[model samples]
Target: MVGDSSYGAMSIEELVKFFQTGKVVGFPTDTVYGMGCLLSEDCVAKLRELKKGREKPFAVFVPDVDSAKELVEEFPNYINSLIKKHWPGGLTLIFRAKKGLPPGVVSGEGKIGIRIPDFPPLIEAMKRVGSPVINTSANLPGEVPPVSHKDVRVPLELMLKGDSKGGIPSTVVDVSGERPVIIRMGAVKVFEIEAITGKTILLSEGNVLNILYVCSGNTCRSPIAQYHLSYCARDLPLFIRSCGTLGFSGSPATENAIKVMEEIGVNLTAHRSTPISRELIQWADLILPMEPVHREEVLSLGANPYTILPFYEIIDLEKIPDPIGKDIEFYREVRDLIVKGNRWLEKHLRERFNP
Candidate 1:
């Protein structure tokens, strides 16, 4: 906080020196202007007191994602995906804290919020500091967090310049729980989170491979293939779903295909169809198409055909016959072919996604 040594503004070199001397300063984060001090009890106490000692915990900001993992117990799998998607942006993720952080940051909650600020100089300063900063917004308690440097309330030895892009604060989530709980919905939306995470928000048991099956129409082959593959992968952590290339969003799986899948121990009675989406394609580590046509569709979405290759590529077939409106035996035959095709898929998966 500013004091007798108040500096109107400081160069990056001066800012680095301020941090080295155990001083708190005002700076910009991607979300808003921020107040930070070197990670130490005495410095944090000074910062917390200056910032009005608000009840909740402060975030510990690292230079980057790897630094974040260093101060936490375990970084979940989905969290790594999120870090890739939104680091250096407005997203505060809570992880179970490791010791050595200031008590004020953890606040005896045994959880510490981690942020990787998108601000360049701030990130550079953090890199040089070689430690985390007690990253909290620059404001008095219960006031709007400052986006522009002009609005900073906490006194500082120096101020970093920038108009804070203040639209929404960083979205906050606690991944230290059994599921990711949305504690605050600010910059990122639930659907966007789901798109990147390949998950329905707050509805998960643990990390799983997101597999999407693509076909001409969702009502038959794709659903049957995914359900059967899901059945085979029951012991593995895999989330399987199907989509159609024709934009058939709500059709049901053909009755014969559903019945045949049931014979194999996968229940498709509740399967609902979805259309192939850019979101789904992005979400999937592997986009498996039932035919060459489906593969082309996936490739049009900027997908690499190497990843979305047709299942029959393994079985030496030109195409996997669509068994829509077919008798149960024909459906059963296609199911058997798909079951064998998965062996090729397993090998390719190990070489490609290896998830």
Candidate 2:
């Protein structure tokens, strides 16, 4: 995720050429190691051979949300909420493919699964290649997918220098239907998908709702959101709490935060910060992390990528500054930002919970 992705001994220039020349590359994803070849006719044939008699079609790695719409014929607006919240992660959306796709890349149903991973190094290569790649886990038919490059058994000319602590598979959903069908249950949970689409999720577990708000210290942004949302959340089947990424246990809210909430007629006087925990992650139906780093923290705690809302990414909400040690005016400014962000979140919640 740092600078140039470690693609074995391949240089960036060499890597770009390798992909452009219809060759395959072995790389890692948020979940497991994978091999991908561009949709060029020759490359797809190579991928097909490596894939080895797998009847299912391969998913494509989309560069971003915009490109996803471009590739999918008459993309559905109903799936926008899920795209914004969970694309570029472990959720692969199935869409109707536009004309002129190569032979074996899509299903007989004329659909293709597209996913934008949360990782950057992998995506950068995709951008350079400027076409969708035949993205699938690097494994033969009926075999387990490898989590690390060393474990990959396929004969790959290029290898990305990376190791993975294998996470869950990308959750595949067919959104082309009248109702979204869970094609495959992977990292993203069923309830999280239901929450985004405003549909009811039914599974083995009963539907007790849990919500988590996360930030740096939990004294400012997240706690403010937690207490305010709590007032309106009473009638719903929700359990709400706030936590910090690097917070101390039982820390009190900042004075400026307390004063600003007072002006809004909300209380932050009883707020105390708690560090994020696995128990909390497993309990939550949805997570709203204040920043990107906090999103990573949630993943570390084993929360599904889709379950945690990358709020800053979801709505293009700019950075909400930490006003913990700043002046009263700074605190007020940051408070205003949180208020604005929370307003949008609340509107979405109303439509989701009530509808």
Candidate whose lDDT is highest: 2
Q: List the RMSD of every prediction in angstroms.
A: 9.4, 11.3
| lDDT values for all models | 0.75, 0.75
User: Residue 343: error of model 2 in Å?
Assistant: 35
Looking at model 2, the pairs that clash are: 6-161, 8-161, 88-116, 88-117
TM for every model, in the order presented, reads 0.55, 0.57
Q: How does candidate 1 score on lDDT?
A: 0.75
Error of 2 at 116 (Å): 0.9
Residue-wise lDDT of candidate 2 within 224-243, one digit each (tens)? 87887776555555678889
